[model samples]
Target: MGLNIGTITDACQWECVNTGTITDAYQWEFVNTGTITDAYQWEFVNTGTITDACQWEFVNTGHDL
Candidate 1:
């Protein structure tokens, strides 16, 4: 799966679980917390106060062909 964000503000929490890719291109401000859990690959781009606390977890169960 894939995801993108142009602007995120005052977000209390965010969670992402994917087997493909994720991207955030633009601005994230005043975000309280966030989490990303991927099995393959992901990307985060752009700037601004993303969050006060952010967590990322990656788990590889197998190989990608």
Candidate 2:
């Protein structure tokens, strides 16, 4: 049951400039043979930079097989 990105249920697109601000910082596993892969090291930003800087991740959640 491995997901390889293209099999996702939803897809979206956007734009950005500063894409390096986001980073992967953590990970974990559950008792039900499930895993958690943290993607975005920094999830918060100022309102001033929200429009100008569009840092993003190639993924969000409900993933990691």
lDDT of 2 by residue, 1-65 (tens): 11222332222222233333433222211111223343222222223323332332234344344
Model 2 residue 62 CA deviation (Å) reads: 1.3
Sliding window of 10 residues with minimal summed lDDT for model 2: 24-33
lDDT of 1 by residue, 1-65 (tens): 22423222222343433332333322322221345343233233323332322343222324431
| Model 1 bad stretches (over 4 Å) | 11-13, 20-54, 57-65
- Summed backbone clashes in each candidate are 0, 0
Model 1 scores worst on lDDT over the 10 consecutive residues at 1-10
Q: Evaluate all candidate structures by whole-model CA lDDT and list the values in order.
A: 0.31, 0.28
Candidate 2 off by > 4 Å: 1-13, 16-48, 63-65
Record all residue pairs in model 1 with backbone atoms less than 3 Å apart, i.e. clashing: none
